[model samples]
Target: MDPTGNVGLLKCIYNIWKKPSKKAIIIYRWAKKMHDKNYKHIPIFLTNKLVVNYGSFISLNANIGRNLDFRHINGIVIGDGVTIANNVVIYQQVTLGGKNLGDFQKGNYPSIEDGVTIFAGAKIIGNITVGANSIVGANSVVINDVPANSVVAGIPAKVVKKLSY
Candidate 1:
């Protein structure tokens, strides 16, 4: 839907056709749906193809909400068990994954809340929740929970600025 409350299927189709990021998301969504239904082989193949083509890997087991904008799809990685809410924009080379193989084995993953914008090369790891409406800076490494409506930066992702809205 547009700002004018208008919805057009043709416009959406055009977007999917023109945007590689949109096409990648659509492929992932379909593959995830198939994986959820216990139809494994094709989904795995499709996801693998995405990885090979886009250098992005979004685990089918990950729970992602609506309107996820893959700002730039290259080198993006979203691991299994991660949860992302609506209206999130993720830039290139961003990783949403557990800290180690042990954490992955334990199904520990980061949960990103709504309206968050993760900049390029940022790594959000461990069992932490990034609060809603927060901005994660480029190349930042987040290992802890981020408070709502804040901007975080640096190696450990300290809250550098608090947002009013």
Candidate 2:
């Protein structure tokens, strides 16, 4: 796998694993048993890297989408109760956490919509909403709601360009 282009295989597996029509949770529970071609380097600590409802996750409270593909998931930590929509792509070392500056209270976790691509080393914190079909570039830190079909890059990820639907 090139790890850069057309990672639809993972998306397909995730879709199957997230569906209610099939044994999605059961398959997700056995995901770690199946080797991830994208994540070749499995950490020693993770015995079975399945995608259960937090049983086999480092921070498994996060809800992964139906069509999700992740590359190099080392050191990646998503916040509790975060919602990831369908067809979302995430790169290595991404951190999707809630804002913390002492006693903090937010409504819900981050909601990343369908067809969104979050690049490597990006940190999206806070209870924000990332619109559909958006692309978050490498090393960006997004703390606010992002518009749909926008390409955001750089620190604090500004809208570089609006994608064409």
Candidate 3:
């Protein structure tokens, strides 16, 4: 049996069934697909259902890449127009949201690059870029751009370490 074939499919199904976060992610993916296919009403309904049932609010407009891994899903709010790259891991209570309320604009949300790990309770606000392969420490408030291959922590997060790879 090929691991990337039926076995992988089954494992993914099992994981989704066992985790609420994965279930929410799957639902969001489905909604996004439906939305892209011009099936508007159903996607809106599904998004509403997910927000009500899972405590996770993900904008259908957010562009997320492959292998989006969520450590926990509770209180995760991903705002509109946020772009997330591949292989990004996010923990609980994380907010990738706008800086100001009732002041909408294009490119107002954070752009998370590939291979980034955002720990629990991290709030990444406004139009900042979290560079590839970087780590956002838990409970950190990030208001500025983070360089690639670095670790950032503390309020108004600053680079604490630069990773080699």
- TM-score against truth, every candidate: 0.92, 0.64, 0.89
lDDT per residue for candidate 3 within 1-165, as digits (tens), equals 895598989988897788887788888999999999999799999999887887889998899999999898888899887899999999999999988874246568899999999999999999999999999999999999999999999998999999996
- Name the regions of candidate 1 deviating beyond 4 angstroms: 1-8
Off by over 4 Å in 3: 1-12, 102-104
Best by TM-score: 1
Report how far off residue 136 is in candidate 1 (Å): 0.1
Which lDDT value does model 2 have at 121? Answer: 89
lDDT of every model, 2 decimals: 0.94, 0.68, 0.92
Clashes of 2: 0
Cα RMSD for candidate 1? 3.7
- Residues 115-143, model 2: lDDT tens digits: 99999889888888889999999999998
State the displacement of the C-alpha of residue 158, model 3, in Å, after optimal TM-score superposition: 1.0
Report the poorest 10 consecutive residues by lDDT, candidate 3: 99-108
